[model samples]
Target chain A: MSARRRLSLGERLVIAAPYLWIGAFFLAPMLLIAKISVSQSVLARPPYRPIFEPSDSLAAIWAKAQTFSFDAYRALMSDTLYLESYLSSLTIAAVSTLIALIIAYPFALAMARAPERLRPMLIGLAAAPFWTSFLIRVYAWIALLKDDGLINNALMALGLISAPLQMFATTGAVVVGIVYSYLPFMLLPLYAALERQDPSLREAAADLGASPAQVFLRVTLPLSREGVIAGALLVFIPAVGEFVIPDLLGGSETLMIGRTLWNDFFSNHDWPAASAAAIALVAVLMIPLLLWERARLADEDDAR
Target chain B: MSAPLLSIKGVSKKFGAVVALEEVSLDVGAGEFFALLGPSGCGKTTLMRCIAGFESPDAGTISLSVVDLSGVPPYRRPVNMMFQSYALFPHLNVFENIAFGLRRQGGTRDAIDARVGELLAMTQLSAFGHRRIDELSGGQKQRVALARALAPRPKMLLLDEPLAALDRKLREETQFQLKEIQRLTQTSFVIVTHDQDEALALADRIAVMRAGRVEQVAGPMEIYDRPATRFVAGFVGETNFIEGRLDRNGAAALVAEFGRIPCEPGDLPDGARATLSVRPERIGVAREGEGIAGFVENFVFRGETTLLRVRVARDIVLRAAACHGERHAIGDSVRLNFPPGAGTLLAEET
Candidate 1:
């Protein structure tokens, strides 16, 4: 009876809370960035020209919006720095995501196949890094990868290398840092997908004359595909706009869009250029992800 | 049995301290429909898995057509098992799932297609061959699992309670279809089931197991009419168990208040305690008869035969099945007679 009843006022408000939070915190800020991206930067307290006044009527707001500038977007096309930073950011994130997938797949498989009593401990171990601050974890990589860091010291003491290797302040170091930081992001989804698989399916495949390798390729691999998609997106999307790992570990030449955006915002105080760069970065990342999400949802609909 | 297709000898398996199966041995004849029937934890499934090569026995050997299978892996063995959950691959359509084993064996596309097409027709799933697994009904999914397992045409087919997931009417239909498929394919089938009626209906021979050991292995009629042990008699069908002492000549069992019930005592020593088992239908009930007289206590309606529980003495009620012979109300006087060769005397008590 209660399930069929109409929602009360309190229930309606409770259900609307999450949508309100997203509109206020995420959508409003993103709208602000978009509005600033189309405006000219000025030598004023706000830096960028205000698109509208609070007191402006709808007619007045429409009139003001027509005069908005595309100068920041035009500047972005003329300068190769913006284009190269975007390309580099995409390339680095793609590589790091690929590396994370390779390492996390086997780890998640092993965890899923482990004895039941040991599973809780394995999950806890994977999540332990989240308890520590993310920045501190990235900085800790410096202690391990720097010229006189623990790795170099250990290699030298073991007579494995004649001198310290240039492990830090390189693109390779940045990739390693990102892969390490987001290993859990890739692993949790893959683990969930693999764990949800019915063990009987594997047994049935083998019984149906599938060799072990064939079983993995035909059954295990195909069944765990949803996990692969979720994990790859989780690591790729955030890594595209990452600032701390690239800034802390990468050399000066290893310029990602996040660092370029930061430089435009802080060093040059060009708010319009930084906002435009941020919007472009989101567009570049969201297009592929949204396409994949659309395809995945369609598959689920067909399943029903 | 024409010839033994699969043979298991003195196979023993233990999971830590618990013995899942102990010295279990059996043979499945070629083209014979066999069933391993038991309650949960009775080792029927364990024995089936050992034959399938999913589990290795700790003590003995399993062989197919006289070839030792001690180190043979499941994929290499000529056996396929349809799981209890039906375990159909969700990612593949029905046609692809059936063709999975064939693809692994690596034949031409046309050959695979022909075989899959034949199987689809056999299972009456030709129209649904392209449907996704989730889009199919529960009964349809079960048929898909069966068709997939049978595609490879292994020497022996193992069904692990394959019909348990279906509803009552669907299960009955699937059971008939399963036996039909087995007959058409001429594949040796070893189905494991806990339902006695299912085992009795489908299996050519049944092995009733208990506590990790075989209690009896016989045909359906033999198992019902002539169970070798007390456990088999009690588990297979409804029967009245009467604890009594073996007569001096070991020809009959002397039940205390009900007098001597005639039974073959075999090699059991005279004066030894024995249990007599008599099927309800074996009992003949009439108002005026030369037999034990008791008051009808209760009635249970079973369409063809109505079962009447007759109270002979305090706390002593014997069930008699009447087939449109006589009608008696509760508290009505009735006479019950155990027909000639009607009861089995087992030396052990349940």
Candidate 2:
């Protein structure tokens, strides 16, 4: 009989390969960005280079050694345009997530309460948009929401607007685009959470003499908090870094951090400034992420 | 006679082609502990839902204190239901769960708190008020569910298999506690359960249901002593049936070739074929040469009693339960006897 052998080096490597790949491809790139954020920019034909040469005196090397510098960060904080764009992105993401939640909640509830035969169809309808390319969907929205697009044309033909209303190329258009793109992300989690909720809880609440509205607020909402939080995170996190929807539908009038970062990197060739802005966004995003993680852990503990 | 506190009159319900309940009618007296007992698919749940306004009957009306409940939503009804699964809100602690109903009626926060505290004390869940539903044991969850349902002090309360989730030992203990709580509150309680022992022990009266209709409704003892149908007789307790014909002797009795035995007619028409049912406990067993001779087909020695299956006649088996001290082996000759007034005449098989 063959003896049970210890795991081979090849097997161990296979098991650890995915993590290595992630570290190499994902974490390495991010660390590189962190390194470039503090380094001085060198202007050349390439329009960007590291400031310090390979060889220099110990003191001079120390002085030029990508030593802690807050110049890029200082530029991000003091610049009014960067500050405005950051604030705009935050507000737009927050408002769009909230709006998506409002729309998704009732839709999820209806799907939850629907007959078994109909549930799959309704859930499929909610999920169908996800199969398509998100960029393509945003482009489709641009076509529909533009000033001279189908929406304005139909409204003008119907005399709803005397002239084509300025719907696209604004903050409202950016929010609409974000909400539209991220709605399925909100719906799926909310649906999953609501579906797992036992109907007995609502019945128990009613039996306890709570009205329908009271049941929703007290039992339904609280019980579904995990899903709500998860759905919010799923939408808000991606919407914060969203670039395609705003670019296609929001036009130039909508100033956002994503657009600003894109402009800094590609247009102005300000690699250090772009990296600094990216780091700041990461820091801002981490606060909520940590809090959400703690809440999620607490919820899991409660479940156990 | 005062009017019944709750009356369900000729109520019927249908789900498409399926009949969930049919012509179900009953009255619950004030402070009565009524139970609806049946096997699964017997419409006890449908009837309970109808009373709670979760379901509206397709025909007939339900009234509580002469107030027609037609078109009344569950929230507007002065009734509550304790679901089979207890249905305690997982998100809310016991205190908030019990306080939910009171708060919804616009009660003052102090009033809600006081009532909830009182209920917690009543259900012996005062210390558990801050505990989440999942944190509770099965018995504690049952109590919290009861407290939550009763917190509103509705005119009537409904319990659907309230103790079904508890283990057998805990179930037996909770049955008495449930009865005591109902008595103490004096709120009309209509509990629905398929467990015959649970219904008999907890209910003042049990409505035995079969296939979407009530077969009989009577006090526990009466339902056991005089079943209204063959279904109720078989469903409620063990019985041995002897095929026979009605014997008119001023009083009715079943006359078989073996002997004549007195029995209740049980709505069986005169000259109709019927079977007389005698309880296994009531049938006497004796050794050969002691009484009517029969061969013991099988004997089971239970701790407290010995149950013997005897072939009294060709293809006719008679079950006899004897005290544990008696020993009767299989193939041993035994005798059987039916004590006076023990058998009940059942209607002819359809």
Candidate 3:
């Protein structure tokens, strides 16, 4: 058969679509940032050295590219500000994801145990937050947590406190914003896992002389490991790079990597330095997640 | 005689307005392989659950070893159930699944391992100890479930449709195996099954249930030969029901279109309506003029026996089974006769 007739046009397009999407959207932008991270900054348009000029010869371009260095990475290493920002960002993400898991686990369990007729309504309510803008939801937390906002007013009205509490512009506020915004992300996968569990297993455990607490500890908790892994990773990965919540809800002292990268790019106008920081953040966040993913997949293979 | 091992009296349960069980009572002997046999929604499972303490009856007392089991939870009850679905823990391997009960009771690691190992060998799952539950086939999983429940060595074991998941050949094999295991363990077994053959083959005594009540409880042979009600006779096996009225002589016989059928003696006013149930295998077939003439309707050639439906009168067809190789074609005339006391007279159903 001729080359064109070997494979149909429709089949070829279907095979190529996913690769094309990843190439155009993910690989190209990542490659651009990587290239910029190794270049030097200069007082010029785009503010980076060793630009790929169409008019230059290959030899000339190669000679100019030799000037590119790892200076931005070196700066990040020497400065404690960036180091502290990375550590604090990781800490905040870990803590917030843990809190979200705690809140979502019981909610998902309740949803799974609910009557069949009421389950769809329960799921829709858990997912209802997605209908509105995420930013608006975070902003709503600001409204509730403000010193003179609804919470304070209610507490004072109840005569439970002598004065309004200082609630906003703190690390607590940032954590609250993340947990609220990502609650659905943590709950959905957990619900899926818990809902799929055959309740007969629990009954069987109880029949085998395990108490309720024992059954939960030995069976229910261990069986939902996949959902726990997925939810923790989902919340942790995005929270590490979260910029909007920290910027809007956190006080001036909050120095997560996202805010640091934003300041380096927009405020300091240092594109190469920001790129270097982003790369460092990704590398640091990926190692643990990849290890966990490998372990989960190995478990799945064994189970199958 | 000693007191019954498990005694359930006046047990009644309702889910909202529908009665799941009503005034059910039973006394299971020690080490007896008792079966609760019924169709779906017939209160057999509900009754089993009540004994297991997964559910509490609205009114009644279930005493294990003469000790009141009221207010006791399933975990606290000295009974373990092999669920209909098996319900093997997917996360735990066979060894751990069997060891779960031992571990919960807090024994030494070595002791738990030894008991689990013994059970694995007992169930013929010795090499599958480390395999995950999902890796095992359906029959293998059933063994694991049985092993797990038996590991606890409770005073009693409740099995709900334990062989329902197996294919026909496997079910027959497992039926004998289950009976053998029960004999070896010497534990009072309450097995719930809707398969009447399974009940007959495995149970020492079977409780036939229908519509939230027990119709009769008797040995398998007794149940087959003398079912207390028409429903029992119909449900347990195929039988020909000859509807007729009692003779005016106050004798225990039914006069139908075929003729007078002698039945076991029962109290009935003269001319009262009654029925006689004759098992197919009990009826003999021979040549024409030797007995009542019956034209063969059709025959089903089962491997060991051929079941022939013979019409003796208008609207009165009797089923008779001949051994394999006994050829009888449809529309052929044959003679059919049963012994004098082969049929059992059934009271008019309430």
Candidate 4:
């Protein structure tokens, strides 16, 4: 008799939970930041002029909105420092992601191809870095990268160098820090993709007269492409907005937008400019995200 | 097995302490549909892998047409295998998957296309050439795997349980189709399977392996009618095993628990303990005859045929298969006889 269907309360909650969480956390903060990006920076408390007040009438609010300053946006456009910082961040992230991918791919392949009993231990080892404090780990790199640090001492002790290398406070050191910290993020996805593949496929290719190199190029590479893309995105997205690594490792010359945003917020007390920079970084990250989604949907379509 | 296309001699492989294969030797002739049949842990699959060069034997030489392939890698060997999972590339289309081997072997585009197109037609998957591997059905994937493996026209093809994933109906249909393909292509095939019916149906010769050793290697009917060992007798088909002792002389009655059963002691000494391996279908069941009289203790319905367990004496039962139309209830009096040339005398297993 009850032909028409209605979702129960529990069913509705289960379906609505994710959207609610995203709306409350992700979208709301984004909207707040966007609003701040258009406001005028001020020397007074809170560092930015209020676009609207609770006591303002509708007409007063409308007038305030019309006079809202676009100084932060205009500053980002005209200043070569902001432009160079953005470019530097993009280049550094791209370089670090590539380095992490190159280093993690073989390690992941070795773990996946290890004996069955050893796989769990290997995968656990890949995730072992997460157990340690990330801040302490980054600080550890500082000790190694300083002018008279452990690395320079070891090289001198080995008689491989006559003097200490200028490793710390350089762009190379920042790239190294980013690669080291994001290595696991790059490794786990690749391991999953490689491990999920049927070993018989490699054998099948080999049996079909493909050499080891050929099998790797034709079968192994093409199949793990999803993991490659996924791992690249995971490392690139976070590295683009990385704040601590570049700050600790690079000199004042390393112009990353993330450090610029940090200075605008904490040191200079330019909240509007910082919000604008943060919003621009988010916009930059959207390109890779949209491309990732398109690839995933295309894969699903092929499967269908 | 003269001038075999694939010859595996004294092949031995071990996994740590487990002996997967032990000095196994087999020869597959040109155009022969050979099957390695066994239960789990029987090394049939290990032997197949050794032949395909996936797992190298610790000590052996596999020769294809007289070339010793001792340390040849799987890629260097001119042989192909159809995996049980079909293992088709998920990213490639059907035509591309079939053409992969040809491309690896280095051929012109037109030549690879012609070969792939011809194979697609042979497998009746011409319309599905453009379909992605995941988009096709299981049977179509199986055909694609077959076509892909056969693209290079290797000296031999190894199939690892080709129909193990299909249902019974499809398995039977594929059996005939596989045999037809083998015949049409004249390709020597060495298929490994745990299903006896599959081996019996598709193989020209069945090599029954047990515990890392080949127990018997013979034609299907020969293996059924004349099993060389007790393990082969029990494994290949359903049979009624009557344990007994041979009389003082040859060509005499076997003194069993029930009564004196006539049997030929092939090579066993007089007074040697033996077992009369009589196939269920070989025994005749009738209402009255000059055979041993017994009461039907139980009957198992199997489609068109019914297997009747007749007790000739107390605790002495013998299985006899009859047509489903033959109505025989429990406690019905009947006579059973093991016809001549149907029962084989095998020595008791050690």
**Top-TM-score structure, candidate number:** 3
DockQ (model 1, Cα): 0.83
Point out where model 1 deviates above 4 Å. Answer: A1-7, A50-66, B1-3, B248-256
Q: Score the docking of each candidate (DockQ).
A: 0.83, 0.63, 0.78, 0.78
Better DockQ candidate (1, 3): 1
Question: What's the candidate order when arranged by decreasing DockQ?
Answer: 1, 3, 4, 2
Residues B148-204, candidate 1, lDDT per residue (tens digit)?
989988888899998898999999998899989999999999999999999999999
lDDT of predicted model 2: 0.86
Q: lDDT tens digits, residues B280-304, model 3? A: 9988888655567889999999889
Q: TM-score of candidate 3's chain B against its reference? A: 0.97
> Which digits, one per residue and each the tens of the lDDT, describe model 2 over residues B1-350?
89999988999999999998899889999999999999999999999999998889999899999999999888888998888888877777889888878887787888989999999999898898888788889889889888888988989999998888899999988888988999999999999999999988989999999989999999999888888788898999888878888866577778775666676776667777888778888877877444557888998887888888888778778888988788778898877776667877778767
TM-scores of the models, in the order given: 0.95, 0.93, 0.96, 0.94
Range of the 10 consecutive residues with the lowest summed lDDT in candidate 1 chain B: B248-257
**Lowest summed-lDDT stretch of 10 residues in model 4 chain A?**
A45-54
What is the full ranking by TM-score, best candidate first? 3, 1, 4, 2
Model 3's alpha-carbon lDDT is 0.90
Interface RMSD, all models, one decimal each?
A: 0.9, 1.8, 1.0, 0.9
